[model samples]
Every structure is written in C-alpha cells, then in structure tokens.
Target: MQHYQVKSVDTKHFRLTQADTEIGELEYDSWFSFTAEIMLADRTRYAIQPKGFWGTTIEIKD
Candidate 1:
C-alpha cells in the first residue's frame, strides 16, 4: 500500500500527492459549498457534492 497526502494550495484548492508525485487535484466551487471538481493524473474527472444539509454524506459522479 502507498500513502498519499492532501496539501492545501489555498483555501479552495488542493492537491493529492504520493512520493512527491501529483496524483490528482481538487478545487471547490465556492467557500460555502462542498460542490467541486476532481481531476486525476490519468485525465479522469469527477464531480462531488454534499448529499445533505450537514454534508455528512457525499455524492460523487463521473
């Protein structure tokens, strides 16, 4: 198994990396919303959003 790290580039942007290599990135649409886009190194993309008011559950779509 490999370990990954989530590094915050700013308040709304982040990168997922392993062994100093970037695997993916996450960017939030807004400060108050959990809706965002995910882009992987392989070019795969996904959209994620909160399912409920408290955002305890997340819904991910490709």
Candidate 2:
C-alpha cells in the first residue's frame, strides 16, 4: 500500500505530498458546497465534489 500525506495550507487549501515532494493540490470552490479542483504535479486536472446523501460520498472526474 502507498501512503499520501495531506498538509493544510489554510482553511480552503491543501497539498498532497509523497515523501517531501508535492504531488497534487486541492482548493475548495466554496464553503457552502464541498466542491474542489485538483491539480496534479504532472499538470493533470480533475474536479471533485460531494455526492449522494448527506455528502457522505465524493465523486472525482478527470
């Protein structure tokens, strides 16, 4: 298994790191809606948002 670390930059921003290198970034779209955009180190982009009931699930799109 591989492990990734999440470091919080602020209330709405976070960094995903492996070892000491950053692999991706997550930034919230809004406070009310749990939506975000993810940008990878390789320049790949994705959209992430809460889905299903009570926001228990999340959906990721490339």
Give the clashing pairs for model 2: none
Q: Cα miss at 22, model 2 (Å)?
A: 0.5
Go through the candidates in order and give the C-alpha RMSD of each one to the true structure: 1.3, 1.4
Q: Which ranges in model 2 have alpha carbons more than 4 Å from their true place?
A: none
lDDT per residue (tens digit) for residues 1-62 in model 1:
98999999998899999999999999999877789999999999999989987896889999
Error of 1 at 31 (Å): 1.7
TM-score of 1: 0.87
Worst 10 residues of 2 by lDDT: 27-36
Quality of model 1 by C-alpha lDDT: 0.93
lDDT of each candidate versus the true structure: 0.93, 0.91
Clashes of each: 0, 0
Worst 10 residues of 1 by lDDT: 49-58
1-62 per-residue lDDT for model 2 (tens digits):
88899999988899999988999999998666689999999999999989998996899998
